[model samples]
Target: CIHDTRIIMTFLLTATFILGAVIAGVYFFIKRIYSYWCRKGVEYIEPDFFYGNIKEMVHGKISTGGLFKKFYDDLKSRGLKYGGCYTFFSPVLILVDLDLIKNILLKDFDNFINRGMYYNEKMDPLSAHLFSLEDERWKNLRAKLTPTFTSGKLKMMFPTLVACSFGLEDVLSEYSVTQDAVDIKEVCSRYATDAIGSVAFGIDCKSLKNPDSEFRQWGRQMFKEGIKGIIKA
Candidate 1:
């Protein structure tokens, strides 16, 4: 019995030491990666150990865009023109200056081609869209699609868009009389859905009138899945 106890204790001690070493190594690795912006002499938001600056986003307390908007507001209030942040050890640059953003997006777009999103073209063929694609693929697809969105094409679609806005107007008018607090984000999302449904699918979704419309449900499901994936990543 004593011999068996001695062997069990030895095994436990070895496992504990290995686990502690692994934990320490991971802590140090994250610390080094998180210091990148600091080493580059750039201003950045202080990040938490594992989730970086997106703890709230990972916890589902805020959407990704909302979190970035908060970051933008915080940095702007601090009188910063630009700042860096971390998304799980990966450094992200936030541009607050209009001229710099314009230059990066328009004048010098080729230099900033990669969006750093994950997409497996072979496994998920549908995921290989323009936004997820990189370099030559993105450029080529964008070039092909650009002409379809020209002024003439948009003007032709304007009447359909205006027709869709009536549903939004009716809903707002009804809400105006009640004077109750409104979720404008949801209302706008429905409006956008209705607009897109009308213009693209040639189906009057009427999502603003019927919040439980099939298209609206689909949109909600897709958004929830996307946010869940972001949190998992």
Candidate 2:
């Protein structure tokens, strides 16, 4: 009985020691990651341990765009032209100056090409769009697509856009008579879907009149699935 108890105690101690070491190693690793911007001599917002600077976003308290705008405002208020922040220990640099943004996006684009987005071309072809492509792939795709979005093409599409707006107006007018609170974001999304469907597919989606239209349903489903995929990633 005494030998068995000794063996059990030794096993328990060894397991505890290994667990404690792993915990300590992970904590230090995270701390090191959080210091990335600091080591580069950049001013940065202090980050929380696990969630980093996106605690509100992680908790669904704020939209991603709203949170980034808030961060921009905070940095600008402090007279910062640029600043660093963390998204789950990944360092992100935010540029406040328009000139710097222009330079990075246009003049110095080659130096800042990678967007750090995830995409699997084989598994999900839609995921490999221009926005997520990097390096040579992005450069090549942008060159090919640039002609499609020229001024003349947009001018030709203007009438289609105007027609879609009329549908939006009709929907809003009905809601106005009923004095119902409107979800403007959803309304705009439907309008956008109708416009895109008309322009791209040469079909009237009628998303404003029929929320369950095939195109609108697919759009919503795609967005829902995309968000879930991003969160899981």
Candidate 3:
């Protein structure tokens, strides 16, 4: 019994030492990543361990767009044309100057090409979209798809947009007659659905005609609050 107890104590001590080493390694790794801006002598928003600088956004207190705008304003107030932010452990650069943005996007286009999105074509084939693509692949795909967004194509779709606008005006006009107050959120969503469906997919969502249409329902599903939306936001 004494020998067995000794063996058990030794095993427990070894396991605890290994676990403490791992914890210390991870903490140091995270600290190194977070110290990137400091090493570069750049101003940056400080980040918490898990939520980073987006605590409000993570907790659903502010929207993703709102958080970005707030960060932009804060950086701008500091008279900074560019600064860094952290998305978890990843370093992200934010631009505040329009001229600098134009230079990066136009004059230095080649250097700023990749969007740095995670893409594994083998595991998720559809994940190879333009926004997620990088390098030669992105250039090739962009060249192929550029013609679709040309002014000529937009001109061809203009009439369809007009038709959708008329449909929205008619719906709002009819609604105002009986109901003084309108759920403008729903009305505008349906209008956008009809417009996008007509122009982009060549299908009329008929969102105004059928409020509970599958397309509109699917759009609502995209905003359903839970782990997915929170993570996305």
Candidate 4:
């Protein structure tokens, strides 16, 4: 009986040691991430142990827009010009001052040219647009696209715009007579899709007439994603 009791005591002590080590490891992991802003000498909001500052966002309790608004309001109320925030373990800088924003975008634009988004042109050529391109590539693309938006070009496209407006009016008039509750956003998106398709692609998407038009279907596919899809991405 004494031997059995000693064996049980030894097992309990080993279990306690393992448990303590695991807890300590977790604590250190979180502490290291939390130490980032402090090490940089930047003022930041204190984060919850597991979720950091975006607990609501990570849990899907608040939307992306709501999360940003919460951060903005919290910092703004404190009268901070700018503040450091965490999106999970990652640290982010939030700019609150209007004059500083104008200076960054206009007066000192070259210093912050890239939007720091990932884009692979070889894998997806369509992704190689003005928004994703960096440095000299962006400058070159801007110079090329500038000519397409010239006064002469816009004047040439005015007729197409007028035609699209008439088409939209006709589509809305029909919807008003038939449906009591029309999805205005869906209708507007369809109209815009058709208008751009005709003018730019020279192909009739007929999105207003046919709800499941090729262009609309393509657009739907682009935005479709599950949790797995997000994880993979």
Candidate 5:
């Protein structure tokens, strides 16, 4: 009797394991390949679970602007109109209907103000910037800061921008004659870092001119992709 009971228990455990595995596999498989069901005559592609329609997004396979364009086009071509598709069960909300986008972004702006993107205050202060804030906080902050970036203030900044451009041009001119490819992103970033430094802190950071400059090195490093994103993600 003892041997028979042990054998039954082992069989039960095996069955349970098999059932769990089957359930999990089926869910992911369905999510990845068939998350979105067509609305009436409209056809739509599905997205993976957890990652949603974010395979290309999180991977940086395409620029965000381009991805939005693609998403819009896919839905528009199929004439989805006002229906939403799944980003792994989370609605992608294809606004092929122009009226809906207009209502959400411009017309009925009060209701759809908050976006649920990640912004860890402790981890990323820059990420906690105005656009990241939500609801009343965002509205109030925007109103408060509206006057800070006025046309007059921007006009005042024009000269500073010109000066920085000249500095960059000067630096670039020395390297242009050489046939070797220049890292424009790196050079431009250096110019930007130094410009922002001068503007914000009243510091003369000649990051563009001096390769060995401590500020310049850090400036370039900031633009370079590092372990930071990996850690954060």
Candidate 6:
């Protein structure tokens, strides 16, 4: 019994040592990458020790887009070409100079095509839609989908837009008659839902008439700006 107890204790000690060493290794590895920005003359706010730059984003403070937006404003104030921030310990270089932004978004688009956001298909299916796909796949899909959204398509859909606007105007007339304060965003979103449902899905969602419509409900629910919206800032 004494010998078995000694053997188990040894195994536990070894496991603890291994875990500690792995943790230490990761800490140093991340520190090394962070030091490069300091050397490159790019000013980065001292990343909250462990979380690097995106500490706020990770802790439900800002969205990925909002995080970059903050950096964009800060660097612009300093007249710097760009600056660096972290997204969950990964370095993100945000460029603000107009020419550089143009190059990244267009001139040499392939070099900076990826937005570096990750989404698991199983977690968000519709997100698994075109917006989530990256690399050449995203490029090809965007090209193919462009034709479906051209001015020609909008011209064809103009009649439907006219119909929906008429529906919306009539609905607003009813509200004006009642003298009630309806949320404009709610009304506009419902009109959009009805217009899109007809043109895209070929469904009649007479949401303009019925305020208690599922189409309107889902439209609002989709952009509710929840806690995730803050994190995604």
Model 6 lDDT tens row, 14-63: 99999999999998988887776787877775676767776666666776
Best candidate (score: TM-score): 2
TM-score of each model, in listed order: 0.78, 0.81, 0.81, 0.66, 0.62, 0.69
Candidate 1 residue spans exceeding 4 A from truth? 1-25, 118-129, 177-181, 225-227
Per-residue lDDT of model 5, residues 105-141, tens digit only:
7778777666654467686665665766787777987
- The order by descending TM-score is 2, 3, 1, 6, 4, 5
List CA RMSD, all candidates. Answer: 3.7, 3.1, 3.1, 5.1, 5.2, 4.3
Residue pairs with clashing backbones, model 5:
none
Error of 5 at 229 (Å): 2.4
CA lDDT, every prediction?
0.86, 0.86, 0.84, 0.76, 0.68, 0.77
Q: Clashes in each model (backbone N, CA, C under 3 Å)?
A: 0, 0, 0, 0, 0, 7
Query: Comparing 3 and 4 by TM-score, which wins?
Result: 3
Per-residue lDDT for 1-233 in model 1, tens only?
Answer: 99999999999999999999999999888899999999999899999888889888887788888999999998899989899999887898898989889999889988777777666789766467777789998889889988878999899889998988888899899899999888998999999999888877799897999999999998786567345578534
Span of ten consecutive residues with least summed lDDT in model 2: 224-233
Candidate 5 residue 110 C-alpha distance from true site, Å:
5.3
User: Could you tell me how far off, in angstroms, the CA of residue 138 lies in candidate 4 after the best superposition?
Assistant: 3.0
- Where does candidate 3 clash, by residue pair? none
Instruction: Name the regions of candidate 3 deviating beyond 4 angstroms.
Output: 1-9, 107-110, 116-129, 133-137, 178-186, 223-225, 230-233
**Candidate 5: how large is its RMSD?**
5.2
Residue lDDT tens for model 3, 112-169 = 7776566667876656778778999989998998898899998998999999988889
True-structure Cα RMSD, model 6: 4.3
Candidate 1 residue 84 Cα shift, in angstroms, is: 0.8
